[model samples]
Target chain A: MPSAPAGTLYRGREGMWSWVAHRVTGVLIFFFLLVHVLDTALVRVSPEAYNAVIGTYQTPIMGLGEIGLVAAIVFHAFNGVRIILVDFWAKGPKYQRTMLWVVVGLFVVTMAGFLPRQLMHVFGGN
Target chain B: MAATVPDLAAPRDPYARRKTTRSNYELYGWIFMRASGALLIVLIFAHLWVNLVSGEGVNAIDFGFVGGKWANPVWQVWDLVMLWLAMIHGTNGVRTIINDYAERDRTRLVLKLFLYLAFTVVVVLGTLVIFTFDPCPTDAAADLLPSFCSSLPG
Candidate 1:
């Protein structure tokens, strides 16, 4: 019979999504980081070699992909800062709701300010 | 005559004082986890789709591919944004787990100290790589290079 587990992994008001996000994103970033470091080593191989690898980035679709990347980065960074404050500082969690709203606000504002420049560049705007 | 505001400053509960000595930090921490996690799902999956699915899949990846992506401001900004968000989210999640698990205050401080150090190293290095990546070196065996090199102005 399918029913809610007696011991819910996420028992609090905070849903499983963020907990899962935090973990998943962490693992993804770590894996990506390894690939990134190795890739950078290509520069030491030769500039042309490096350029060849990088040349694949030039596409409008890829530009769209970049938009998603920024969203991930922004949310993760903001949330990470929040967690750091809560852990190191005793009173950090007191303002959790306020902080959550603030993070969202910041994410939106930052993306709005930044994404357009990306669009213009990808479209070959001056 | 009806009372205008009925002691507007009066406490809601006669038993509870208006100025309690309680701090609401845990409340915020809990909320942050849920909110950030929700946002991470979209960001993470989209990243996967672009890198692993769209176009030539992972095999299409190379110096040229990356160079091509970053050549446009869109991917550059995209990468930059992803770096900042994920780094902060992961760091914060770890910090929370550490606080709950760590007992000694000094121990907590040391753990976080190292965490901050690692975070700094990653963010700085990542930013440098994204902005400063130069795929085309001045002197190299042109034959070994990608086809695009032949087109660059000598």
Candidate 2:
């Protein structure tokens, strides 16, 4: 028999990269969720307290940050479905690479739909 | 002529244990991730639509806006479910990451300890906030309260 290959099975492939993105986004979302809950909890303290914090989120910088946050969440959500299909569908293994492209396409369409409206909200005075 | 069939089920070593020592805990965790992930996609997408995409978008979110939404039972329950499911799902995801990266036993244990602790605190605090929230606190300025608050009888 021939000698085995030197490199790893998943080196720099789409599957590996998507897996990395999923983990990174998942961790980022988790941290955001923790802080989100805490910020919402400020409602218990007082309206002023809550408003003071939430007001910051409405600023231009944070509005941009919200875009990034939503981008991460959207990618994670789509990729998560791709993962589920890969696990459960009969032909999933055969088509995982194709599915990644589909996920990217959907991500682009989604961001396209979201960006304009959100941009107006952020930059449109009042 | 009589035909004899051998017992295919018989173990080669009679003294050896037949069953595996493995439990289904990890299997169940794996399934939970997929199931919860599917549900969270819907829950959170709708959540984003309402909170960030509709009407005034992010600019509309404030104490009064939150108070208005939580005033209804539907929103209260919606948020409660979202809070619980998201926390559990996120905690479990992080736990998996910790297991993968943290090679040392002590390191894994300590990391998971904090993970679980944060999960419990966030879940409990979020649940309480949703259920026990007073949309119209009398002490707060009227301007900060939802418009409907002023109409309610004290």
Candidate 3:
């Protein structure tokens, strides 16, 4: 039997990191969707309850949180499509890393397009 | 004294790990994931655009706003589809994670039990809310009703 090293840093490649990020974002989006469902369900309880619940989300802090939620969604969706391509396409695995970089580039561009308008909604003087 | 005997009833194939004979379920799930992801992009972005990007943005999301949107069958269906697809997709993703990480059968069972329960609750409640929502209930206590409810001609 071979003895294992005391401390082994398993440095994973881009594919591994993308897998990790996919799982993380997936879980984050899961919980967020749960809360969103419950809050949206407030409409059934009473208008007061619904309005009050939604009103809490209008704060600047929640605005930032919404940005994070959107980021999670964009990453998960983009990576999810990449995963599908990898699973089904003939040349997918060979260019998986390139696909990951493409996902990241799209994520950055989408967020840049989204952030200014979102920040203005949050911080622009009304 | 009874002799201790080694158990020999188990299957001899050490590599045999209860493989699924049904391949179509997974194939369908994979297809569903991509199909739903594509649709969700449109549904979610349109939802955000209507609710937060247009008009007064997030602040416009109130009882009246939601009521007005739900008053239309189109928005109601859009929201219903979004709720179902997102919940199902997320639940399946987590189920995959649980299967990968949970070493013990009992642990996997318990975790998925709870996951399914939560999924059921969200889907059922969300669907019911979308379909059955009454923005202006005549029977509601006047104090609990939205201010606009009083103005509508009965």
Candidate 4:
């Protein structure tokens, strides 16, 4: 039992969610990798055919899709780095708490860097 | 009866038994896994539905389909975000796995160096493709150009 008591944040649950995300992202990224590789192979299949296939990616709806994908990737990468630290360094536990904020800081910086253009597209600004 | 074995007390250094100095890295890492993961859940599902399940379904995807998506700046940014996120996520996740398995200090360093290198290559190339993709390329020359290109007034 946690000494922190109920009604407050559940510490264990937080860790559980992280583990689950790590696994789930693994599977999803693998699936996407397959499709991406196959699509790239189309380049050898003649220019017309390849161009046609790539063209659909330009659609607005799909544009949003891309945003969602990149976001998943960035988050997974940053958090993954954090996990690596914990496993190797014996001192990992000492900084585990503060590292959460670092990851968030990175996440925010990443999103801020890209959001302007992303929102511009949705709003039809550029 | 179990075989009896000799028990010995190992000498311990004072420093070895002392609580390690703090760094809070684990706390952050643990938090990141859950938070990013929660977000990935929505992003990942939305991705699948649009690409594989929406109107015309998977068959609807093709070169022209992709070109169309990127023509809109929306997708350019979307892809940019997804690429950044997944790459970071996968890289970080792998880093975790690496630390867990690789014991030697030198080995860990070498492996991470490679991982980051691969991450950089993929991210840079993917971003370039997203931003530079051309839908209506006529550079193949008029003879080899798509019929649609020929019909458009120059």
Report each candidate's C-alpha RMSD, comma-separated, in the order given: 12.6, 4.2, 8.7, 14.2
Candidate No. with top lDDT: 2
Using all chains and alpha carbons, the TM-scores for the candidates as numbered come to 0.52, 0.91, 0.83, 0.50
Candidate 2 wrongly placed segments (more than 4 Å):
A1-9, B1-17
* Segments of candidate 4 deviating more than 4 angstroms: A1-126, B1-29, B140-153
The 10-residue segment with the lowest total lDDT in model 2 chain A? A1-10
The sequence of per-residue lDDT tens digits that candidate 1 reaches over residues B1-154 is 4767575655664665589678987687667655655565566557656764455544456655666667779877877876776677667767876786687799999999988887787787778888777656566665544567779999
* Candidate 4 residue-wise lDDT at A9: 47
lDDT of 1 by residue, A17-60 (tens): 55556566565555455456545556556666565655545467
- Name the candidate, 1 or 4, with the larger DockQ value: 1
C-alpha lDDT of residue A22 in model 3? 92
lDDT of 1 at A76: 68
Write the number of the candidate with greater lDDT, choosing between 1 and 2.
Answer: 2
For candidate 2, lDDT tens digit of each residue in A1-126? 434547756767788999999999999999999999999999999999999999999999999988889999999999999999999999998898899999999999999999998899999965
Candidate 1 accuracy as lDDT: 0.65
Docking quality (DockQ) for each candidate: 0.10, 0.60, 0.54, 0.08
Q: Is the docking of candidate 2 incorrect, acceptable, medium or high quality?
A: medium
Ranking by TM-score: 2, 3, 1, 4
lDDT by residue (B1-154, candidate 3, tens digit) is: 2567775666765775688776688778878888898898889878878876777678778777887788789998999999999999999989999998787799999999999999999999999999889989776665555566778898
- Candidate 2 TM-score versus the reference: 0.91
Best by DockQ: 2
Task: Report, for every candidate in turn, its global Cα lDDT versus the true structure.
Answer: 0.65, 0.92, 0.86, 0.63
